[model samples]
Target: MDEDSIDHNKSVIIDIPTDLESNQWSKCWIHRIPRKLRKVKESAYTPQLISIGPFHHGREELKAMEVLKEKYHQKLLQRLPKDGSVSNQMEEFIRDSYKEIHGRYAGLSNNGFDDEDQAFEKIIMRDACFIVELFQRNDSKKESDDDYILSTPWLKKAIKLDLIMLENQIPFFVLRQLYTITAPHLPSVNVPITQASNHMNPFLKLTCSFFKDHIVKESDWEKFAEIKEIKHFTNLLREFWLPREFIKRRNPQQKDIADRKYLYSATKLDKAGVTFKRASKGTSLADVKISKKPVLKFIPASKGMKLKLPELKLENDTECLLRNVMALEQCLYPKEDYICGYVALMDQLINTSEDVDFLVERKIITNMLGSNKEAARLFNGLCNQIPREKTFYARFYNDLNKFYENRWNVTRSTLKKVYFKDLWTGSSTVVGLFVLVFTVTATIRNVYLRHL
Candidate 1:
């Protein structure tokens, strides 16, 4: 645990086919990355969480990646222009085929189902997995603890969660992970992102926790020792996704912005990071003294004593302790999905809309036909559903006493007054209501579970 030895085994290396000059890394990227990221540990640099922006930290990077991807797709179009030939005598045929595909896509319209929340979320999840995999093999880091790597998915749940993310990109990783002698052997695949939804196979969404002395909790770290799916994880990164850090650097920023919540672009390098105050670890629940007595942790609120955990509570008991504890499931909001899509739509609209004042002017969503109007509608709908204001230990609280008290009423009131009905009409209104209800329910559920 000594700070001096934290660099042990941290070197990493990445091999790529580069047509550029050999000295290019230093010239092109050295100034961009921080020193710590550039350090030659056992093999490569340690990975970092790619966050950006104030209220919406992860948005910029992912959005940039999406834009870059679309740009690449267009470039591909340019490579074989609408009239380009595939074979000696296939010029006309290929052009016709391209035209048909383009026409079909165009017919779908901008308001099509192409930009669903699930689709956007899938992009983020895949990108996260890509970053994880990039570090797993291409960039290996030395360990500070012979015990656990701070960044790797050493926990069973983390790994499984990542695998779920992986399925969106490289289906082969799933196949290989499932069949490989080493089940966790994540590998790369040349598969397209839209290749298969069947990749959701074995997409596990489990909610189980390890009790204080439970083996499942204790052994969560032990699973990483198994050298299983490194390759599978690696390839999935290389093919369909790029490192979060890569995308993070390219994000656009607002002028004159600075806030604790705001995450600026991230850069990786072989240098040390700025030493902010490390989160305090000695703050213990049972150690807080009450009435001049060292508290060894009693159930907060005498009522908690009556409520036993689900596994141990009685079924016959009316105000069942198990049910009370079980009622504590957390329902998470897909804030990223909602916000990302909203931002993208807003960007598109603001950038290309013929009329900017229409939304702020009439304020009638239905009457406003600009794409941004629909976008603003969707954004407000989701904004209404997500938990905006803060909650209190509540955040990372491990104990039941420090529970969450939601500020949902404020958010609800905001939604109620927004005049959503004006924006989404008829069938769209109904669908919006349904989605809003579902999102609210899911978010409440997620919070309850986490707090419980």
Candidate 2:
């Protein structure tokens, strides 16, 4: 062999061991958006305001947050112990956590730093401290004049959107480690420090409080108590929307069965005698099902079977939030993709703006995205490159397909639309039918008399 080719082969042989040494799939949570998914909407997956982790660390557009991050880092240092041993402990913990997930960050550039681990350690500490400071500030009722992030309305909104992006995430463990060290020294806020310990993790409590409006109602904060582990912000957001019972009753080995051949839209489902109903209060987004009978058997209900879906509020930032969460599911929980399941179901049910309008009328969707078409496009685009091998709503989709296939449902739906459309139409149709029946009866009686 040529000398150059032999050297190239030797280098390739050495690199294989380096690759396998870092391949810890279980620890891999944070990930770059797969190219196919990113191409569908590049801006949706990219951070607009601030970059949080090593994936998008040195972007020019996000450079503004760097100075602010440093400021927060300095503040965190003042609160934390200055002892060399304590600092070393945190640094070692951060390093080990990053090492476990190093394979996920393999191709990422280290910017100007000579050593990759040194660069990431610096980035994690700064980002984690900033997040910790920001959450605590957001939780506090009183605001400081020097606090530019909270004071600037638009900036605050952008950061919230940016923080949840899959590409822009520090490992949750890093945040947890930092929070554990800083919580004791954190300045007292609205609540007494002693009482704050009542929560499973005071850090989690602060996070939930910060994002309460975006995720759930204030009354539902108690739900977080049941959660045991959180991978990162994106995962946390997904977890918030997942049904509590599903989490408790989930079977890791249980496989989902999807009928990919059958695709039905909202309008089509309606025509097939499926009555869309907004799920009752306190239901999670993952709580979807097809009910054969009405919720209240004694009370009269609409025609056909009922499909219960949780109410979805689509806002300006919802697309970004949902897209990132779906990316998280794609990377970490491919088999148990609850968020993707919900999105896929919605995409199937909303083929057009008409479907969006139909669901909006049923209160299944609160379209704040200005128009139904925009909401329809959002749902349609979400599942463009997503996989559906398994989903949380597979059984629900199967039930819907079965319900739609019944001939009786189509007949009932047709009857309701043609004759029983309104009080006047129904009454007139009933009277007209009675008249026809009476005429036929008279004719039959006359024929019998003649025969006698």
Candidate 3:
């Protein structure tokens, strides 16, 4: 072969450093929705009302909110002491922290404003300031009645959903830095932002208010005070929904439930003599348990067994919200895919409309999707792109399967279903047995008399 041809035949090898050896910044939790997953439901991953981060910046559709962002920025600055220096201070902070902010976004390209430091600073400052102002306005005491976004219910809801999208997030520390700078000038509420010792963080309070509908009141934000770093709004929301114990016991290296061969649906378990019971209000959905006794006294005791499921509030936007969170978990925390594991467990438990019905009747699932079929479809679709791996509820699934497989439990369930199919049938059976016994007694007595 010719020397040129020989050279061409040799493959060029480029060595990339391993995750350990690479000086690569930690995995930026913020990421664009992967196309494979996004194709399933594009709208859920895309920002509809407003875009917060660089992922959707400069899109024509989201341009309308640009003016609104500017207005909010001005309003926030207006709240500051009348000195012109506050704007300069904010600009300086953004410039100083620009590198840190840039490092927090995954797959950030240098093509857009990478060389334009001032432009990047402007975008971050404006976006961060707008978010802080929006959160501040959500609190009723500080909100103006005439606010355009707040006045329009649809817009407000859309904005909230948009802000929580994985693609539409800024690092939490960036927002916190901005908040710390402006907190002194902002109006005071029941909890002041300046009190670092207090359990209630102003940033957290703002986030909870913005997503109040999804948050459980039982969430203790005080525990979060000890968390030194939080990734972004999406991460915070995921953490908020988790049980305190789960958070404390969580080990990133621990293997999940991916090894279990079988997972039973609610209906299947019910037929196997396992009674479905709703968990307490504050219980994390991840804390599913199977036990011989009902976890809550309000739930009637049933023979054989009980399965407890945490309360999941379903709504029109729940599917969209959950899908994004699951996607984030899959991308950022593959080893500790808590959200993905939860969705996988739910997918197993809700394979059909019948399963949805079983959960709905027992109050284990609230079907806000207008139909049980729709709710079933929502859950069944979530895990389609998710990798099937060890789930968080593997132990619960394994234990419940063992209980359901018991021969005695199955026989008892079948007998109860057949003999006591309904009240009228059961009553008639009892009456008929009574009459037969009485007739037999009379006949025997007459026979004895005849013999005598």
Candidate 4:
């Protein structure tokens, strides 16, 4: 080797120690969306009105929320005891462990703050308290007359969307810690608190309540009753909405994802004798199933089939919510990227406005976006830059593809479309067939008679 090359190798070896010392993979839960994903639809992942965490903390567009955050923080302080023990303790803890706090986010810039200064403490406390107070105030029966966010319906919804974005998050532990310290001093409004130390985690309750309207049709409290851990809002959303099957640890030896084939579009499947049914409200998005049914109850075997899909309510912020959760799965739980899998499967099923129209007609998709083409585009865009090498829906896709490939179903569907389009066409076809049969029978009879 060249002498200079040997020196370069030695320098590289020496640099490895410093890199290893700074790496904090264990603490990282908050992550920046990969550039590839961000480029697909940057607005989907970017916070629109507010920044909850350090990633987009100082953007000029979001600075307006900073004033409100400070106002909320002051309100949170007023809720605390005058003795100020909890505040002092939290401040000291953040000051001492600021590096640990900063390390929770991967690729976070220093932003010119060295160690835990007053600026850093203000940022952390304001952000954390702002969230807690927002939730608590929203939970209150009597909304404050002067409360700008709550009074403004559109702004309140915007803030909710902002909070759920992937980059706009702090470590969940920070929020919990702040809430735990202040819970005793704060008055519990809607949820009665006999003592501050209750068995139920009020922070979780409030968090779930805050996001209840957007994510699910069921009662969030009942669904997440036995909740144990949460990393952040994004993580909570992923866990709450993920299929029950993928919530558990995935088996590595499951079928290879490469072998998975995309299912036919909704319109195509409908034309192939497949019936689309909106799964019950209790059904998970990942609970998609393809079942074969007899055309008649009396018949033992038939080509009739049904595909059940859970109802999905798409709205203005639905893309943001889903993109962030999918980004979280991509970064934190690559192997168990069930949300990604679900969206990708949907992307396959929706190729055009016609497919969206079919699903909407079936009640499988509630198109609040107003246009079927827009809904179709949203589904198609979701899987951009999403890896397909592993998915929770491989088996489901395999089953769907197998069902679609059945020639009998296609032929039957074709025959139905051509011969029995409606009562008029069907009656005409039957009568024509009968006439042709009669003519053939008479011709055969006359030929036999003449031969005899």
lDDT of 2 by residue, 1-452 (tens): 99999987875553233345555644567777877788788888998888887878778988987998998888867777777555567677777776654555434546665577788778877888889888887776675335788888788888888888888887676787778866777876543333323664777777777676776455565666667788788888887788767666655436577876346888988888787899998788877877677524675653347888999999999888888888888877887787788888898899999999999999999999999999999998888889777766777778778777877777888888899889999999999999999999999999999999
Q: After superposition, how far is residue 447 of candidate 2 from its true place, in Å?
A: 6.2
Per-residue lDDT tens digits of candidate 3, residues 1-452? 99987754442211111244544535567877766688799988999879797878888999999999999999999988777777778778888887888877766764566456676677778899998988787665537466788778888888888888999999888888788888888866443343322665677667665666554242445546655567888887677656557677665546645346558888888778888889986676566676676434775654467777787878988888788878888777777776777777888888899999988888888887788888888888888777875766677677778877887677777876777679987888789889999999999999999999
Ten contiguous residues with the weakest lDDT in model 1? 266-275
Mark the regions of model 2 whose C-alpha exceeds 4 Å error after superposition: 1-23, 80-114, 144-146, 189-198, 294-303, 422-424, 442-452
Q: Residue pairs in steric clash, candidate 3?
A: 257-390, 257-391, 258-389, 258-390, 258-391
TM-score of each: 0.18, 0.85, 0.84, 0.84
TM-score of 2: 0.85
Residue pair clashes in candidate 4: none
Residue 146 lDDT (model 2):
51
Predictions in order: lDDT: 0.26, 0.77, 0.76, 0.77
For residue 329, model 1's alpha carbon misses the true position, in angstroms, by 12
- The candidate with the higher lDDT, 1 or 4, is 4
- Candidate 1: tens digits of C-alpha lDDT, residues 237-287: 121111122223433222221112111111100011111111122211111
The lDDT of model 1 is 0.26
Q: What lDDT would candidate 4 get against the real structure? A: 0.77
Reference-based lDDT, residue 40, model 4: 91
Model 1 misses residue 67 by how many Å?
Answer: 8.5
